[model samples]
Structures are given as structure tokens and as C-alpha cells.
Target: MAPSSNLLNTQIDDIVKTVLEDATGDVYMVNPSRDAIEDFVSVATADDDDLPTVHMLADERTLKDVMDDFIVASNAADLIDAGRLELRTIEEAPENSLLVTDDAVVAIVHAADRVGGLVADDEEFVSATVETYAGRWDDAEPFSLRTPPITRVRNTLSEEISPEAEDDFTTILGSLETARGDGDGLDEVTISLLFAARNEALLYDISKWGEDVGIASKATFSRTKTKLEDMGLIDTEKVPIDVGRPRLRLKIGDERLADADNGQLATVAQSMLN
Candidate 1:
């Protein structure tokens, strides 16, 4: 018999509600960002003393932006950290966002946009999805190593050195931006700037000085900086630039970049940013 489309839609809706609304059991997800996943967990386990253990397998490319979002928002960080959420990164991302209970009684696979997908209890489908997840799990790496170094308390700035330096750096940035079409333009620009830099730390501070040198905006530069930091392609340290306050220095990933040749480093940069 042909099933009623209306009935099927209702059932699917119910399944999604159950998976997101219920405040019991573990939750697992695959997403490029924390967009809806965070809310899913928060709503699922609200008011419970023992919250569900949440596990996320996300794309490595989005790891920096994700971490930056968490760092910028204290509430999000608190919720995830308090829930003891375990995070890992995979180079390839899933086509949909997944939410599975520990008991495997309910599994919801939403779209990458977090808008829709199947929410089912079918044992075979659930089992198959779990198996695919296991494979991804093997390829994933811990999120801790990819987290940004800066904290909320640390007052960081990207103050451009001087008017003379800005003019020279602006010209350099324009030339490098010509390579933008091949990969992540901002990211490639950031990497190229750091790579071609003679100084150990490039003072092209994103927050404070990016606009002066043709960077689109503070947010754009900050995001690129975070991604570089997360990929272990860059590092941040507070240098005592004056008597009053030390400035945050963004430099190349010395441990990796030190021994690497320009060609080799550029290849890696392209791989990461592209």
C-alpha cells in the first residue's frame, strides 16, 4: 500500500522533535560549524544534572572559525565545555549533520544547512550510518591541538607599525592578492604575507591595522587569522612592545615552517587554504 505523504511527514517531524527535544542519552554530530548543533545539545539536555556526552566530527578547514566562534561567545563555550563535548576534525565533511542518541534508538541526519534530512528508527539504516561514522572517526584528530591560543582575557591588537610600513605592506598585499582566484583569497593573502615576511612576526595586525592596508574589514582579517592559527600555520604571542602593555604577535608556524622550504611551505599553504 502507498503510504500517506502527510502521515510520513508528520512522523519525520516527530522524530526530529524527539531527537532534539528529549533531554536524555548522548548526541553525536557532523557539521562544519556549531550553528545548530550547539542549540540541539542545549535544548536536548536542559535542566538535567547528567547531560549527554556530545561528540562532533567536523571539517578541519572550518575548525578555526568554529573555535573562534566559541571563543568569542562565552555562553557557547561554557555550554560545550560544561557538557564535556568531545570534538575531532576530519578533512572530508559529511553531506548532512547527524544527531544520534547513545542507545542508538533515534538518529537524525539533517542537511548541512541544518534545515532538514531523515530522522529515523530503522535499525538497518541506523547501523549503516554508524558504521560510516566509525570510519570517519578513525580518520579524525583531536580538536584540542587545533584550538586557538588566545583567550577572552588577553587583550590583543594588530597595530600597524607606521605610515611608511603601511605603504610598503599595502603594495606587497596587492601583488599577493593577485593569487586569490586559485584558493581562499584572504587566507592565501594572510599566508603569503607571513611567508614573504623578513621579520619573525608580521605586524599586519588584523583587528587594528587591516583596513589601512586594504583588508576588507576587521572580521574578515580576524577569521583568516584564526584559521591560520587553528591549522598550525601560524602562532600568537604577546610581545612587550611598550612599558604599558604587550602586543599580540602573529607569526608563522615556526616549528613547521622553520625547516620547510618556500616551495614546500607554499604547497602546504595552498592545500590548507585552498
Candidate 2:
């Protein structure tokens, strides 16, 4: 959201993409500056708790520089193609250049865990690491210091989530909406409808809930409604609009279950504007 005169319009889909691309950070803010957006994306993805391996890769050169140049190859791709990076023989590795094999380079790079300093002479380290991996014992299972990496948080959510939960949630939301359209149907009609809404609206109620789930009684609906009202996830009002009248009417919230019906997205949006 920006000043009407800004003329820079971005879609919610684009904002969501930014959130996914840079997960777990600020999704929206007052100003959508480029630097701010990038920083938000970076920080959202960055783990503050995973502190820098202070002593892990600390060496003559900072790990950032080594990882940046050697590991990530951040140099200009065109310049690299031009052989701008010349291989000057370091005192460490003479006969065996560090650039011997990609696998060898990886082995040497990983050996930092076994080393003392944060950074080491790249030339010598690469050659030694290569030589270490080539020995016959590399095939030995126990000799391998490297274990499978700790699964990153990204991996867990990456698994294909069974759409069952999604569908069930959708169904619950749909039921709430259908009930809203079915306003004032039966005297206690709102009771069953609101119950369905509670069963699926908030994640807690619906997390373990399954589709075609059991129906809720008016009493159960009361409990769930209180919870929903407390969270402000939904609004329920029992009021007598006309003066001196004692009739109870139920009005739904802005976030009704009908919001998820994709076919009516445009229709809903149009209604909202009106």
C-alpha cells in the first residue's frame, strides 16, 4: 500500500511470492522500497539463531571472503571465462594444483571442520583435501567424517502437503458461507452453521479435524463461537435492531467462508467495492 499518487501498483500475488522467496519475515510494510524489500526477503530467509560459525571457519581469511570467492564464485562469470583468475602456485601445493577435481575440491573445502583455524591457505588446503579423499579408505564407511546434513527447515514444508487438510478447511469455510446465504433458515440454523465454521476457521480447531466430521450441538457451537470471537477471527452479534424489539439476529463477519470460493472472487471483490 502506498500513496495514491505513487503509481506503483503491486499485486497480492506478487507480495506473496516475495514472502515465499524470502520466507518468515515481514510480508507487508508501509513503504515497499527495493532495499527494504530485499532486506526483508534476506532476513526472512536468514536464521539469526544460527550464529556465524565463529570458530568453525575462522582462519587467516574470513569465511565470508573464502566462501564468497572460492565456494560461491561470485566473480563475474565473463571475467572467469577470460581466465582472469590465474593459478599462481602457492607454497602449500606445488605438484598437485588445487583445481585437480571438483570432488577433490569439495572434500578439501569440507575438511575445515577438522581444521583448527577459521580460514586456511586455499591453495594448500585444496591440494591436501583432494589427496585425503583419493586414498582407498574413502570407500570405508566409518572413515567418512561427513554425515548427512541436518535437514533445513525448508525441506520439511517442501514435501507435498496432502490436499486433504486444505480441502477440508475449504469445505468448512464453504459451509459457513453457505450458512450465511442460508440466513435465518431454521430457528437454530445458525447454531449448526457456526459450529461448522468453528470446526474449520482457526487452525487449532481444524488442525486435527477431518472432513465429513461430526456435527456440533448448539452448546458446542457456543464454546467455539466464544473462542472465535475472542480471537476476532469472526464476529457474531446478538442484537435487536428495531427499537423495543426482542428478536435476535446473527450477522457474519467480513472474513466469511465464502471468501475461498474461487469462482466468486471477482464477484466478491466487486461487491466489496460497492
Candidate 3:
């Protein structure tokens, strides 16, 4: 296959901006990175009611930085905030690069080193790619409520717990569990909630953790979150984004849990259980 003479002269970023700006109904992308999606995010969030719904599919390794960039872009008011944007991870590497809007297939990123691939409006290729994208979208998890990355949490725990004794280690974990527990016990729902807050996940993700743990249904996640709030175990703060209302971020409310040291278990248990 031969490259388009026109694409040889075009810059990658410019092509991305053009594709995103030209989108009307929806946007479908495969194997996108932070730099690849920057312009698309800007164009998608520009309008309030009319923003195109975006669905991105990529390998698990790339999802973290993509999510980080989305967070930053949403904060900067460059994308729609009403959950219009969604992401999913695929186990297999994409066979071909694709960027599709409702109207056309704007770009294909074939090789990592190449500046660009075929950029065209071939009717057959666009139709086939769009069909492929729809299947991937249906199977992807909701990034808003997706599990917090294990690597991020591991890094945090490693920094805090190194050079510690067995007793101190027990105390740190015990304190966290006690803070999330009530007079009854630390059930799965409670434990899951604590895990999310300890990792400083957003409220959306915390609720999903409940569902992931089989807490009756998705609605129960919200009820569980409210229960935690009422118990003074967790707190929420609104972070402004591009559209609708600001997103709520979850945090551990108890100082005993935050401190995570000797005597923390007793301190939190007394307040939380009593």
C-alpha cells in the first residue's frame, strides 16, 4: 500500500485536530496516547449540549496515561463532563490504527515511527472500521468507575511502609479496616470502600468498587457510599470539569486512618464502632 502524498506533507497533530473538529455524532479511536487525544479532547468539550460522544479503545498498558490526560483535559474545560467520554482496554494489540468520526475515517496510525498512515474517505474502509469500533465499545468497561490501577496503589504503600516492623504493618492495615467498619463488622462492602478511599479514588470509582464486589447492585454502591459519609469515615469534594456539575472526589475522613501508625487501630475503632 502506498501512503497518501497529501498525508506526507501533513503534521500528526493537525490531522488529529481536523478529525476531532469534524466529528458530529460520535468519535471512535484505536490505540491512542495522550498526545494523540489532546486535540480531540479540546474539540469534543468545546460545546455543552452538542458535544460528540467519544469512545476510545486501547491496550491496558496505555490506558493509565490516557486516563491521566483525560483528567487534566476535563479539568481544563476541554471536553464534555457529562460522562460523554468513555474508555476500554483490549488484550490484543490493534491490528490497524484508526480514527473515525460519524462521517469519515480520518486517520490510520500504522507504525509507531511513521508520522502518519493512510488518511482517506474510502467508503468500504470507513464502514468496516466503524463496525469494528462498535463491537469494541460494547465490551469495554466504564473508565469513570473502573478499578484504580494497582501500580499506583503499590507505589504509595511501598513508600509509606518500608523499614517498618510487623507490628506497625498490622497497625496500618487494622486502622484502615476499623475506620471503614461499623459496630457489626468489616463486611466486603465496607472493606472495598476503605480500599478505594485509601487509594484516594474518585467517588465514581468507589461506587463501582461496590458493584465489582457484588454488593447487590450498582445502586447499592451509592447507598454504601452514603452510609460511609454518615459514619464520618469518608468525605467528598467537587472538582470542576468542562460540563454539567463538578465531579466528586472521595477521601478518607478520619485522621487516625490517614496517620496510619501505632495505636491507630484502637483510636479509629473506638470512634467508629462506638
Candidate 3 per-residue lDDT, tens place, 1-274, comes to 2123335444566666556555666777777765565545544544444545677777666555544331332322323235566677766546665677655765555455665635666768777878877887887765543333322333333443222322343344444422223453344345445555656666665454434432325576667778888888877788888987887776777876667544553455345746
The local distance difference test score of each candidate is 0.49, 0.28, 0.55
The candidate with the higher TM-score, 1 or 2, is: 1
TM-score for each predicted model, relative to the true structure: 0.40, 0.19, 0.43
What is candidate 2's lDDT per residue for 170-206, written digit by digit as tens? 3333333222222211111233233334333332233
Question: Can you give the lDDT of residue 208 in candidate 2?
Answer: 21
lDDT, residue 136, model 2: 20
Better of 2 and 3 by TM-score: 3
The reply for model 1, stretches above 4 Å from the true place, is 1-24, 32-34, 37-49, 70-73, 76-83, 102-114, 145-274
Best by TM-score: 3
CA shift at 229, candidate 2, in angstroms? 2.3
Question: How well does candidate 3 score on lDDT at residue 76?
Answer: 26
239 in model 3: Cα distance from truth in Å? 27
What alpha-carbon RMSD in Å does predicted model 3 have with respect to the real structure? 15.6
